[model samples]
Target: MNSKWLWPSIIAVLLIAIWLYLPPGIDPVAVPADSDSIARGEYLVKAGGCISCHEGSEGEGGLSGSAAVESPFGTFYASNITPDPETGIGNWSGEDFIAALRHGRRPDGSFYYPAFPYRAYKGLSEEEILDIAAYLQSQPAISHSVAPHELPAWVGRWQMLGWNLLADWKEPGREMNDDPEIARGEHLVRNLGHCSECHSPRDALGIIQYRDEFKGGEIPDGHVEAIDAEALNSWTEEDLALFFLIGMKQDGEFVGGKMEPVIEHNTSQLTDADREAMAAFFKRGLPASP
Candidate 1:
């Protein structure tokens, strides 16, 4: 190779390497399943809010396709959630499904980006996650690979490893208190519902500000005014569940950013009783603002 061509050739190789190493979206493979398992899987899928994240607003057949989720880091497209063996979760086993939710590890052993909300999901029970997995397996797989996330060159994926260390990831569940009303509400909002993951402000390392609790702030996906600590001090418990169920309140307008999808999927699916308990829990003697 002549010296004049050497630099050009190297540049081409580098580009090729980056392209090849980019994240891939292979739909899960299909497996043989019984009717009972499929029904259980359906319930699990609804509980996990699968459709809200996977399906794009403009996607085909109300299925997950190429919906782009804006984040503090960058934009990430939701992958196809259909059961197409080549493009969806058809091939994933119950164990593989469990690993993704509980451990946040893909079948290939690569870590999933936190954009997937496994941070909140890490608290889920094993049985709960397995049920979700079974439900996903029942869906029809669609063969569509979303575009790879384009992170800035300064911030490599390896940097996420450092963030994870500081995160002190834990399994998804909250300790129950003696009060049935408070505990039921707390469990619904924190574990299965995951409101704080979006509503609460996070520290630089991405841990939720426990002191601030439901006091909301600007999250990665978008800004949420009055969710900050000060606003919650004045609101009643009815305020909290209404916020989740309707995304707005009497005193303020709805700050619907990423939360729109959540209401559409998770909160909307809850029974009226569950929603009320959640409201009661949020209203538990809110601290007076300093």
Candidate 2:
């Protein structure tokens, strides 16, 4: 038997498969010059909390993507997301943007570190993804070049394939009987808001454990712990809605730490009905604390 070539043949096949799975590159699309697209994108950007990691503050350099995101692995610098042709996503095609957001694959077919939260973003609809892209394109281009991520030698793009294989890549299926409010809450919480990404405990591979969904876990900094979503179930809907609206807990203490920015940039911007829906959804779905 020709056992000598067997290993080589297997390696070649695996390489070819990986290549086939790589996202294809496309030419950059022309940015839409309309106000409606920009407005929709603005709403989605806030809903997705893009500003928290990308902008840092309200003044200049918004979406320049220079913010530092610390993780258990290393410090990952957010890329320049502004429309700068040289340093940002200005020249990215709609497909290129979508590939990055939905598949975590760069236009050059490299994997983005999971710190970017593409796993949660993969659940977003195509229209929403495009709208976000359009909004980014409409922004004034910034020329900030971010430093590369400081990662361990073992952490590489190839590992992303294995991660995706093990992770829940598919969006959860919608139930036929889901009311509009429930559906909206589910979409906001699971996809755009991505609350569970922080709230759920993760395995060694940095994948969120479904068993611990919204049950609380250590944040990336290794010091602060995320509050369990189920814990919020004790609060009345009015209290929950008010908390989201004003960043004040039912106990009269102001929300602080990482959650402060989330409320400021994301939840505070949400509509009253949306906040109420989220409160109702959390109360109904999250398990009661023991």
How close is every model to the real structure, measured as TM-score? 0.74, 0.88
| The best candidate in terms of lDDT | 2
Q: Cα miss at 112, model 2 (Å)?
A: 0.8
Cα lDDT of all candidates, in order?
0.65, 0.79
What stretches of model 2 exceed 4 Å from their correct place?
1-5, 8-16, 24-31, 56-60, 169-177, 220-229, 287-290
The ten-residue window of minimal lDDT in model 2 covers 169-178
**Residue-by-residue lDDT tens digits, candidate 2, 195-238:** 88888888888888876677777865554444455566568888
Superposition error at 61 for model 1 (Å): 3.2
